[model samples]
Target: MSRIMVIGSLNMDIVSRVENYPLPGETIKGIKTDVNPGGKGANQAVAIARAGGNVSMVGAIGTDVFGDQLLEALQQENIETNNIIRKEGTSGLAVITVDSKGSNSIILLEGANGLLSMDDLTDILPEAIKDPANIFLLQNEVPWETTKNIIESLSASNASIYLNPAPAQHIPTEIISKLTGIFLNEIEATIITGLSVIDQESASAAAEKLIAYGVTEVIITLGEKGSLYRDFREHVYFTPGRKVNAMDTTAAGDTFIGAYLASKQQGYSIEASLEYATAAAALTVSREGAQKSIPYQEEILQFLT
Candidate 1:
């Protein structure tokens, strides 16, 4: 099976459904509420496992009830959580407000996620990621410094590295250089490149900037407009998103990146993998919650056809 290692956040998500987003200082009525296991890392790990890849997670949760539930949920998805640590603080949480339009606004509290220290990472050692079978998946939810150290430790390994620079932050050019793959939205890409991405043209320009910075490949997600991808060979492709009524856009990009990695590890071609990834993301937006919305491989295959 395709083996994957993810270093990111694990969070408990509390969701509230409303008629529409409340105005500043204005209260609105909600239809329902629920709690779910989330965090971009956990979502991606579940996605990979559900898509038939072997996945492991290295992140921290708090020593709280929510953290306990998050771990249980991940175990149900068959993700390897042997390295997941529990800290003293509250687990990270995302307070999500979803409107009837399928749009969402989130308030993220980086709680125990901040406690994932270099020591915790060093404990996992080089073997976890040093082998050729490992593909490292990273995001910005946790401390980028710790991520930098991990990337540096694995720099000489034959394993591949995939980074999703979400909630984009200012990182060194060297980190960008180490990536085997990168997934970003137009806005995240713009944050890195300072490009005015009003459309595909600007998106291309932004991707070019990333390539110039040493990323081997780049994939820029453009919401409903679709996605743009470029490889080392200068071959560029655009995958148009399939339009459907969206229920909640939470975790859509995470699902896309996760499924894409899983498909690639399963030996699917670039085009086919993107198609599968797109379909997986499409299914996520049709539902609610983070991990709750990720589709199974069978569901994605059906959607593809």
Candidate 2:
């Protein structure tokens, strides 16, 4: 298995189920509430592990009870938590609202996630990136400076650097150039490229724009419409989404990214990797929660068959 390292945030998700989203200034009662382990980093780590990858995680959590539970959850998924730091105060959190349509809106509290510094990564990355087959996965949940530092340090390394720019932020072209692959949703693509990505054509255009900005490869995920891929070689294509009755779309994209990388590390071609990832993500949406929703490798393979 390919060695994977996820450097990002860990959060406790406070989820509320609702019939419909509340309008601005509107107050509505929630059908139910549940606290789940989440955060893009942890979610992806869990996805990678469940998809049969060797994965470790690097992030921070607080000394609070939620932090303990979140760490336990990652361990339960067979993710390595040795690199995870324990900080003072509260762990990160996400207030998520899911409607009957399985769509969701979220508000983030960075907390300890924001506290991750370049110093935190300095001692770990050199060792982590030593193996050429190792992959370093990152997200926008951590501080931009910390991410920048890691990328800069690894620019000359052989390890693959994959970035999922969720909750899109302004990233420097220099840092973008260092990435081996980038995964982003339509909205995130739009934010990064200043182009509308409502359909395949536009998504392709947006992906090309990102490639022009120096990223070696780019993938724009379009929810139920599937995803678009573009490489520095000018190879561009779209993979149609697998049709499924989505119950909760949470962690669907994370599952796709993790499974795709895992497949690639296992030597599958890009097309095959995308197919496997699509099947995995489709299964994820048919379930609920974040880590709870990610399908195992066997489940994904059976679904694909």
Candidate 3:
């Protein structure tokens, strides 16, 4: 199995199921509430591990009870937690609301996730980057400076760097040029490229613009519509989304990213990787919660077969 390292945030998700999204200043009743372990980084790590990859997670959590649960959850998934730092405050959190259709809106509180610094990464990353076969997965949930520092430090390493810039932020062209692949949704793509990605033509255009910024590969994920891929070589294609009754979209995108990377690490071609990832994500949406919703490799294979 290929080794995958995820450097990102760990959060306890406070989730509520509602009949419909409330309008501004409107109140709506929630059907139920559930607390789950989540965070883009943690979700992706769990997804990779569940999908049969050798995975390690690097991030910080608080000394709070939620932190302990988050740590335990990662361990239960068989992800390495040796490099996870525990601080003396509340862990990061995400308040998520999911409607009947499985669409969700989230508000994130950084907490300890914001406390991650270059100092925290200095020791863990050096050894990890030494091996060219290792893959590093990153997300914007951590402080931008921390992400930037790690990217710079690993720029010369042979390890593959895959970034999923969720809650998108402006990244320097210099740093964007160093990425091996980028996975992002339509909204994130619009934010990064300043182009409307409402249709296939526009999504394709936005992806091309990202490639022009020096990225080796760009993947624009359109929920329920599948994803678009463009490489530096000008190869462009779209993979249609799998049809499934979505119960909760939470972590769906993360599952796709993790599954795709795991497949690639196992030597699958890009097309095959995308197909596997799409199937994995489709299964995720048919369930609930974050890590709880990601499917195992066997499930994904059976679904595909």
Candidate 4:
């Protein structure tokens, strides 16, 4: 039985609800405010655990109240957290503003998340590299250099390494060549490939470019439209998005990635995994918050059935 090892950031999200976004220099009143446990890495880990997959988390958090709360939150979800480090500063936080339409804009403060060093990630690979069954998941919430170092280090290993390059940054083709694949949203795909991905045709073009750039596999999630997976062999799998009254879409992408990975690890076919992930994401968008919005395995099973 293999498990997923998530090595990345853990952030506390401070969210405010507004009818719509205010223009620059314009002050607006919020409908409500809520604090939620979030972070690309932490969200995916929680999603994996709730989706019934074995998962362990690794990252850095500050010695602040938010850090403690984040740790406790993950523990409550039954996610393994022994590798999370404690730093002497404020924890990472994201200031989010969600509109009544369920769209969200966010500003991130790195804080202790930037303190997650490459050395903190090295020990997990030695044993994992020897096994093809082990999966290492990464995101761009931490320092780019740390993520780059881990990807480079795994170049010679047999372990499955997948990067969810959110908060998109410039990634070299050499790095892509070493990955098992990538799972990212349309915005990330646009940033990474310098392409405008407003629909499937554009997403298809971007996926081709990523494949040309050396990524062996690619999965691009298009909100409302659907998600598509592309491999080097030119095979394609697409999953249409389920329609629902979305309350807050902040966690939908994370939920999809986690559910897809969980399904794959649980021995489902690629098409089946994408379908499960789509259903899980539909569940996520219909709710509010981050981790709290992600559906449990039983819920997803029921939804699919």
Tens digits of lDDT, candidate 2, 61-130: 9999999999999999889999999999999999988888767888999989999998887789888876
Reference-based TM-score, model 1: 0.93
Per-residue lDDT tens digits for candidate 4, residues 1-305, read 79898988899999998998999999999999999899999999999998888898999999999999999999998898888999999999999888887678879999899999978766766756676787899999998988988888876764688999988887888888888889878888988889998888888898999888877889999998899889899988878899989877878999998998999999999999999999999999999778999999999999998
Give lDDT tens digits, candidate 3, residues 136-158: 99999999999988887887775
Clash pairs, candidate 3, are none
List ranges where model 4 is wrong by over 4 Å: 18-31, 99-105
Q: Each candidate: what lDDT? A: 0.86, 0.90, 0.91, 0.89
Model 2 TM-score is 0.93
Supply candidate 4's per-residue lDDT for 61: 95
List the pairs of residues colliding in candidate 4: none
In model 2, what is the error at residue 241, expressed in angstroms?
0.5
Residue-pair clashes, model 4: 0
The C-alpha local distance difference test score for the whole of candidate 3 amounts to 0.91
Q: Residues 96-158, candidate 1, lDDT per residue (tens digit)?
A: 887887677889998999888889976585767546777899888898888888777777674
